[model samples]
Target: MTRLMDQEQENLWDSVQILSQINAEKAKAVFKVTIEKSLQQLGITVPVFSTIRLSVPSTDRLSQLRQIEKKMREAYAHQEKEKAYEYLVDYIERLSQMTEDDPLVVRKKLLASLLNERYKRKPKWSAKRYRLSASLSPLLSKQVAAAYYTTSEVAKKLGLSDQTIRRMCEKGKFPGAYKTDGGHWRIPRKIFITTPEQDERAEEALQQIDIKNQKAGYVDEFDL
Candidate 1:
């Protein structure tokens, strides 16, 4: 509320503040009656007032409520100032409309009319950030696999560095592991092996060939 030169104007500002401060529905109704009498005396229209309750729990909620209240107060003050601006514009428009000669005045009034246009609502960080933190915490700190090995454990078992294992999984070289809420990684036991079987098979094949050649071929000339 602001100081006014006239006692009637002071009463009107007081009525507005008083009406908005009433928390209970019944009290607000009585305040509105008082405001009506003030309005009749001042010959001015009163703005509608809405009460908002903070429902969240905890100390954080207290800070959030205070911040919201501060912003709401500023918004109300802005609205009141805008009303004064609109009154001046209305006065000018009335004068311009009487003359019906100034196109620039008409354009200015049209632009001024849009000054109090609806503000776009912004997303609240309290709920959004809290939910997002919950959602992502599971992803980052989960445990998932047969060996109860985290992805890091699987990497260590495979003789690959942790960074290399991550790169391999990202490149689709190895299957992904599951993650649990407790931040453990579990890899499928099938992907890990004792050694490459192909090398063992090649060694057996070479021994078989050497035995066959020794049996079929004649002895060396020196041995004969």
Candidate 2:
């Protein structure tokens, strides 16, 4: 990627030098004058400006900008709330420094509106993704958050039965668990840490599970 970028820059530099030389030669060959004067010198009657502003979006630049917009919207659609928020904030913040003639100026406003609306919804997201989604403010990433795991996965890691984890979550033991609309428990990876008292509670819970399972003619999943 670095090499490709360098090669592209080198080509652009070379092209710029060649074009600059050609333009310099042309400027020396033809003295600059008002368009009216030049037309008068050529015995023409049409009036024209001495300079004209050319505004066009290059193919690569346009494609890159569109790709960014696509990713931003996709993140939102996929429910990656944190990533979507960051993308929205970045694009909207960049809008002010951009010239009005920039190709994406209109898109900036459009995306800003769309993102701000979506951000205001404030979807219940995981720890790493708890963001201030309502504005184009600096991203405040949570200090310790990585990923979301299912209840089953968390149970396996903690050496507890799936039923035990689900029951605990349902009983409000794991407050960090977020249930989706479809009745699925999505637990944050950071929620497993226990206080000393909580650890004692967990031990007692497992012992109770052992007793209950033994009486029910089943095996408890306690590692001890």
Candidate 3:
């Protein structure tokens, strides 16, 4: 959280990002009360985060092919197998360079082949010893939790200036979000909802906020 302020970035901490997958309902309720009061005093709204469409950079064929391979690894790590398969198919298609004639059945087999390589190797790896070194021990350090997105990231995505996002955040437009002592906004990703409904947009963002709070892990928090 401090890192966000240090870099003059947008950093939001909401129920989902805070609790991740922990099911301490009682604790959540208590924290909710405290957080609401804090937000009210700060004049920042909840859902400080919001979705904006960001521009994609130009990619040559070689880079695009590398991205497909990297995406396969990412989707699999996120446990998004369906997406992983899609990436796998994309990889094979690039290899074949024959998208016009390839069939889905063939692509499916290629995807399976990709998965099989990992599945077969999984059992062969030996477990490594785990230890907490003195320098890395919890007693000597304060661990600050985090999510991947930042204020700069959101601005880049929305194709707007960071100052605009920061201004919106400061105006109490996004509830469950707050400005830090240094004036940077701490925003959760759920705050981004691009619906045309004037009144329902906040409502939709709030619903997502609740859903993410109930779930564990940041990997699937957005579901966007």
On lDDT, the candidate that comes out on top is: 3
Off by over 4 Å in 3: 1-145, 193-224
Worst 10 residues of 2 by lDDT: 27-36
The best-first sequence of candidates by lDDT reads 3, 2, 1
Work out candidate 3's RMSD over C-alphas: 21.8
What ranges in model 2 sit over 4 Å off?
A: 1-146, 194-224
Please give, for residues 99-207, the per-residue lDDT of candidate 1 as tens digits: 2236465545434433422222434443222222245656543422223345666453433367655554455443334434454334444333221232233234334
Q: Write the per-residue lDDT of candidate 2 for residues 22-120, one digit (tens) a residue.
A: 343221111111111212211122111112112222345334433554555556657886786576556444322332345355445445444453344
Task: TM-score each candidate.
Answer: 0.20, 0.23, 0.23
Comparison by TM-score, 1 against 3, better one: 3
Taking all chains together, the TM-score of candidate 1 against the true structure is 0.20
* lDDT of all predictions: 0.35, 0.40, 0.40
lDDT of 3 by residue, 85-193 (tens): 6775566565344222344544454445435433444334321111223445564322311321346755644434688667766775443445444445655544332
Compared with the true structure, the alpha-carbon lDDT of candidate 2 equals 0.40
Instruction: Give candidate 1's whole-model lDDT.
Output: 0.35
